[model samples]
Target: MKLFFLNVLAILLRYTNASASFQSRCLAFSPESTIFNSTLTAREYVTKGTNLTFPDNDKSCNQPFQVAAANLCRIALHVPTSNRSSITMELWLPEQWESGRVLAAGNGGIDGCIAYDDLAYGTEHGFATVAANNGHNGTSGKAFLNNPDVIIDYAYRSLHTSILQAKKLASLFYGQKYQKSYYIGCSLGGRQGIGAADRYPDDFDGIVAGSPASDFNHLYAWRASFYPITGKNTSADFINAAKWVVIHDEVLRQCDTLDGVKDGIIEDPSLCHFRPEALLCQSGQNTSQCLSSAQVEILNRIYNSPLYGTDGKLIYPAMQPGNELKASTGLYNGLAWPLSQDWYRYVLLNDSTWDASTFNISTAMLADQINPSNIRTFPTTLAPFASVGGKLITFHGGQDQQITSFQGARFYNNLARGMSVSSASLDEFYRFFRISGMFHCGSGPGAWVFGQAGAASAAGIPFEAENNVLAAIVDWVEKGKAPEGILGTKFVDDTVAKGVSFQRRHCRYPFRNTYVSGDAKEPGNWQCRGV
Candidate 1:
């Protein structure tokens, strides 16, 4: 009996030791050891927590990844004597992995949560992704002034430091140096991607920036200007949400059929020669349903952006027709407006009492005070970005209502100019695709088709029934076969609600998809018309 008991005790001890060994092995990669080159050190790894969540596939209901959430360990590097500070960050690794590559993403506005979809996509592809809150967290515009640290971080340090620390961590964990590095983001993320390529070309190998906010200062100032018009008792108040619906309906009635089918989707908003004044109730007999004169003027300005000269020459394209009302949600209405107001009042004027109403469009030099889109000042020259051999691909929905697709086009054009290259030459390093009929980011009231899953969302636009932009990025980076054109579809099943049925071709830059002489629904009915 004593010998038998001794044997049992030995087995128990062995089992306990094995379990401890497994736990230690899982935590082999520590963030502190991950250093960028030999000069910088990663701050301590901080585990935010973990959760069990379903994978991207349908079986996610049954089998899920042990999702680990962590705050990137960071070193706060002071920028000279300025109030601004930059952060060097190391994304804490999952407990299971010994080593993984790093993906640095950019944040939008004042809120700095790495986009949930982007993060899921990156981690699933076996990358440890990192991003910064860009200093302050509320809304970017107002937060910049209230906290000196926030503005400085957003200005330059956040991107600079994050890259340095991420590289260091990669070396520490893998023992082998990273074979390749990539960057991916849209909108503000797009801006950051460009900034890195132009400013710190050596940081990444491939970058995918969609709808970049290149001119940060000008864009923010423009948002401030629009907020007063959209908010307050000005003409915008008369138009309001209800009027937006009416305008949307009118735009659909006039241009929805331009694509050769009355499928409720506008194949091209640019081709939509819509005039809101046509909807106005004849002369003076006012109806609550029809727009007032002030309302009509406001709609025109909102849709037409700010006029640069007397001839009504456009400085920037206005939000497309169907997108006027949706800006009230997410960062656009909630964060952007309040923050812009705060910046105009507190940061610029140093007087919180100043009313936005007092500012006049014709006389006031708002651009001088708060400019977010000054390319020259914050220019992203391709030389810096190209030297690193980084690849960047950007996509924006042509029908995007929040920030117009023109913004993407303009940035790409500027990039090409800065690089001293033609569109064809840049195609090797960077690419842009304008998804037709899709809304801001990815969600909208259109039938967007991808893979074999017919129409994915109620607001999804149908073209290529299963072509996902995120998936395209993965294919592009891993395979090296650049996407030439993406397929778009139009839905037909639910008559009341549009469904994906017809396919359209989305041509890359310098190549515009033009309708053939006969059939518009047929894919062969369109050809790439190069500029």
Candidate 2:
């Protein structure tokens, strides 16, 4: 008994001393450790109870940074490039709450602003989080003018270098190596995460990407051509929100029960072939409930995959059905998308005041030649990433009109073919989830809430356990448990009706959620099986 107690006391003392050393060493990042041959612009040791405040003018999330005074070590790094543009990275270390892991996230849009909300969420969850400004520090594409170096950083280097530094800093601060590293992001941020995995294969063990803008140059070019091709001025002209609701109702009527349930969601949109021509108005029979021939043509164009006529090459993937309303309102509202404009002006044209209306196939062909986003954003080869035991999980909203959910499927299919692996084997490393009735990220008519960073929430579906993307990825990395299906909830919010309406489990790719035999409304009634 005495010997056992002595052994336990020795172990406790060792841990206590190690904890003390970790705190002291973390607080000393400003003075010690190798800089990885980079310059440190600033370092601050935030004590375990400090409140972080944002500028009043910064209305990003409309909430000032306020957390339970966490013990943190913050560091700012600058990596210089040939064109005199520098990559600025911020690393936040959790001193008091060490999760023995590093979580590196990325930015949205062409905006180089660090994602504060994502960083806060990571730190609060006991992760050492880091976010970069994607090379420049502004919300516009003006920074990319005549700056090829900054463009390269934005395309890839910013995340790669920042993650390298973050991991190093984590090891230096904790005096122990992180058990695993993960990347979490959405939209442009999602592209960054995949870019990191492609360029820097060993950076993360697991990654969760949502609505990724993978084909960077073509995506923007496609959006730039939307208004011209649609020949409509606003979403109201193309398909009003009310009209979309009508179309959605019709879609549900036709395909909602194909999954053996009429829950107002087309579970597998791939299985749905809802025809818009059926909604066409007959000659001499004009009605608000039906679309005109022109409207039907435009809808078909919007839903079909775009192909470049110049070389007969595919540009964008086919858009998922049922997102017509949101796409009409948010993405394809006839007006030029600002991000598309930014891509043409800064990255492609080098003219700050270039007219976007003149954007055409010729300009796109030229942009494709100088496509730096190709090697970084859309790496055709991901074997290096998979070789490092890295896992990628991406979720796309079926109702996401902005980027479309079909991009995920196209990318995965290509990835599997490129890697020479079967779909089942590909599922071992990469998995894609298609969320029904979910808009860009979340929030739509169906059970659209899955707890992801910048994701929508449903009532009673808190960001916990397997319901959360980050949590699911963490479990996959730490426990070698790959997620079979993710649970989604429909609840009352400002956008959705009140109360816990239903819970649906969205199965991973290759394995679909099928209704067997039971109460169709209950999640237990469904099982994940091969189609």
Candidate 3:
């Protein structure tokens, strides 16, 4: 009885000490101190705390998100990288930070929108979180026009500088040095994550990049190539959303059972030789449920690797077979994707009037030569990052509609060849997981939610190393427990409140989750087998 009482007292004392420490630290936090030529523009200390519903007052950025955090110190900084442009960042310091870790989240697309949701996400996890508006502001990349400095900031400068500044600020606030640092990003954020690993190898100890748009010069080219094929929504070659559903069903019918399960996931897209011709319309067939002959040609171009020039050189990896459902929207919505439009016009050619119709196979080659703001990240060896003992976990959704899922494999294969190390050896430092049925970063027919950035963090999901890729990476960096498979959860109706519907332990690269026995929905029934 006495021992129990004493233990309770000790717990109380510890809690009191932590509370007072946070109080003092919060009070002493100064916004005046700046690093990397950054100006401390705003500071906010929240007492009400946040529950993913905090009202935002910062009007500096046109499309600022309503911050989803509470009980933290928020600091905003603006860094003028060059005479023509600048970068903006927001740093959050939480009271419950016991891990002594720093976190940086990447931005999506070419948007200079600060990852406010990510900042909130990291803060709740007890991390001193920071997110930068990848140079410029708002969701548009038009600012890249006539601003090479802005492009430079977007390409690499913003994230690197924001990280350094955030770390220094956290040290000042806590009066101690951080133990480790991490990065989480998808798409363009994933691109930035790769760039950080390549250029500033010492910045992050662990990086979790999902659907990384890494092969920048070619990625832009790949995205632009689609506009010419699909033309407009009214074009004869165009396919509607309803017919796309029919196509998705056809793809599943052909490929779903390849992994010995009819679970709607194409575990390995490579295993399936997708036949778009199989989806062709028969005479007197329901036109709405089938493709026209020209539409079949469009599907052929999409399913097969994109080719350019008279000699037919492959431009980029083919679109994954299973993403047809998601392919009906976003990048494939029969219009010029703004990011591609802006990149070709502003960043590459510096001609706003440069028609996207003129964009072709040679455009990709031209982009390679110009390489605006030096944003092309592919073909660079990750030797420096690997040498520094940096643990990297990159993932691409198998049903990804934005960027082709094959790029991650291409990157990993090259990494091993360049380093002259077998994949078994590379497993010690870096691993790439291919999440089945996941579209872009998250959400799809399969077990898509794996506790990544943004939505996953705010979804009220448990932050276990098994289900969370970020937690899994931290486990690798801090505890030396390398992940062979990341357990993914498919929430019922994509919401935690609805409860979990199913789960899958998504395998690391060179391996696909093979069915052993029992129910297909059961995660244990699947094993990571070599591809």
Q: What is the TM-score of each candidate against the true structure?
A: 0.73, 0.86, 0.93
Name the lDDT of candidate 1: 0.56
**What are the per-residue Cα lDDT tens digits for candidate 1 across 447-506?**
344321111321243222135544454456567667787665546752325545666777
For each candidate, what is the lDDT? Answer: 0.56, 0.74, 0.82
- Give lDDT tens digits, candidate 3, residues 101-208: 999999888888787778877887888999988887776778888888888898999999889888888888877898899999999989989888988999999999
- Can you write out model 2's per-residue Cα lDDT over 1-531, one digit (the tens) per residue? 999999999999997786677667765666224654567766766655566665632353344564533566777776665447777677877655556889988788887877766766677667888888788876778778887788888888788877777887787676788778889888897888788788788989999888888877777777787766665564444666677777777777878888887776777888887688888888777577889777787777776546474787877766677776677676566667788888888877788888777777777777667885563277667888888899888888877778867788888877877788888887777888877778877677666667567423422454565677788888877777888888887775534446667777888876778889888657888888887
Candidate RMSDs in order: 8.6, 4.7, 2.7
After superposition, the stretches of candidate 3 with alpha carbons farther than 4 Å from their true spots are 1-24, 51-70, 308-313, 457-460
1 versus 2: better lDDT goes to: 2
Separately for all candidates shown, the number of backbone clashes (residues 3 or more apart, or on different chains) is 45, 2, 1
Q: How far is candidate 3 from the true structure (C-alpha RMSD, Å)?
A: 2.7
Candidate 3 lDDT at 318 equals 81
Question: Candidate 2: lDDT of 336?
Answer: 72
Instruction: Say which candidate scores most in lDDT.
Output: 3
Candidate 2 Cα misplacement greater than 4 A, ranges: 1-28, 31-51, 56-71, 76-83, 96-99, 232-242, 283-287, 373-376, 454-465, 494-499
